[model samples]
Target: MGREDFERMARAGFIERNGTVVGDYDPRLLELLRAMDLAADLPELWDLFDLMKAVPLLVVRGEHSRLFSRETVATMKARHAAMEAVEVGGQGHAPFLETAGLPEKILEFAQRFASSVRAEAPSS
Candidate 1:
């Protein structure tokens, strides 16, 4: 499923023009390996979901990403009622890698979350 989507994106000129660099061959191998490494080498880091209880949580989603299902987002929102989810336009699973302007959206979300945190705190 993932491969098919990636192939489609490549054909649509989403990747590099040079075969290895972009729309040529299997480019998603690198991202897949990185995710695998994170899951395998830092299994404990996955538990950060619980640690989010002590900090502000912002959930960023790419509008087209199959990686995050609506049910998962709902569960996260239920877990952290204060959490905010923002979806970026014209993007898929790895928006940062696949689309432009996603970084700007991420920055904007961070800024908004920070301001909200400061606004809600009691005065010293």
Candidate 2:
């Protein structure tokens, strides 16, 4: 069922030409990969979810994303009653927040969850 959608994403016609970056592909690609090896000491943050349970949670995912699967989203929703999840259609791996109506959705979420709270000005 998702084959046509997947193929549409793969075809050259699917790419937005105006957004294309004209570059020498190979060397920059190698540099990007090499940069990852410099981060051996990065801290693991998978358990941070437990710490965030006290706050309202919002998860935005790409419909075609392999890294963040629907099953994982379902499990997270099952665990957190306050969690809100939305999948942006026709996107993969990561959706550009500026492209989709993501900014509006995120803004709505913030209003719903945080509008009631106010930060007090610090005493001088």
Candidate 3:
């Protein structure tokens, strides 16, 4: 996003400023002028999602995330059966995991998966 775009989004309360996010963001399409600062190259990964369908998936989604839309979440669930998805209210992409009860829920999910995995026997 250019300076003008960031300024516009900030003015509209879409982007965060000073560590505070305004709730209830309506997803809007924006022109991609260039690659993200943190990303080197953006590769298509829908096939990867199909390839990993057998693996368990726990999706934490922001209700208003434009990048990861609700349709995407639904598509992921349709592609995978052993999937658990949690949507955070009034948040955008990569919602703050420190939000109420999120940390505990993540820990619980980890423990559940950890106990379910069987350890391989050592071949001494």
Candidate 4:
């Protein structure tokens, strides 16, 4: 967005500054922006409630991360009943990169989730 447009949106309460919200030069920023622009407050998925009801969700958190709070996790669970939250041990924002064994932990979580998904499927 142009500076003028962004400024106007900010003034109108449609957008606000997200100061250093993510790690510096986080490549995920662009992927996230492409998926959904937080500044616009746009709804990427129209039937979010419906989808939430149909799917299981896992929310992993860094123990010391400031990006999301306990309240946010609670709200997320309230919104989607099938949500699971995991906290990485002894780390802060971007713990998966900062802490040792993080990759293993994440991979284990993924494997378990996948196994559960397959188990839940109806047998042909």
Model 2 over residues 64-92: C-alpha lDDT tens digits? 89999999888788777789998988887
Residue pairs in candidate 4 whose N, alpha carbon or C atoms collide under 3 angstroms: none
Kindly report which residue stretches of model 3 are placed more than 4 angstroms away from their true locations once superposed.
1-44, 119-124
Candidate 2 residue runs with Cα over 4 Å from true position: 1-47, 119-124
**Superposed Cα RMSD, model 1:** 7.3
Q: Write model 1 residue lDDT over 8-96, tens digit each, in one string.
A: 66666655544555444477777877767554544543356766876777776777789987677888877777777777665667555
Local accuracy by lDDT, each model: 0.69, 0.74, 0.74, 0.65
Clashes of 4: 0
TM-score, one value per model: 0.48, 0.57, 0.60, 0.47
Q: Report clash pairs, candidate 3.
A: none
lDDT of 3: 0.74
lDDT of 1: 0.69
Pick out the ten consecutive residues of candidate 1 with the lowest summed lDDT. Answer: 37-46
- Residues 61-89 of candidate 3: C-alpha lDDT, one tens digit per residue: 98879999989888888888788899988
- Lowest summed-lDDT stretch of 10 residues in model 2? 8-17
Which candidate achieves the best TM-score against the true structure? 3
Using lDDT as the yardstick, the better of models 3 and 4 is 3
* Model 3's TM-score against the true structure: 0.60
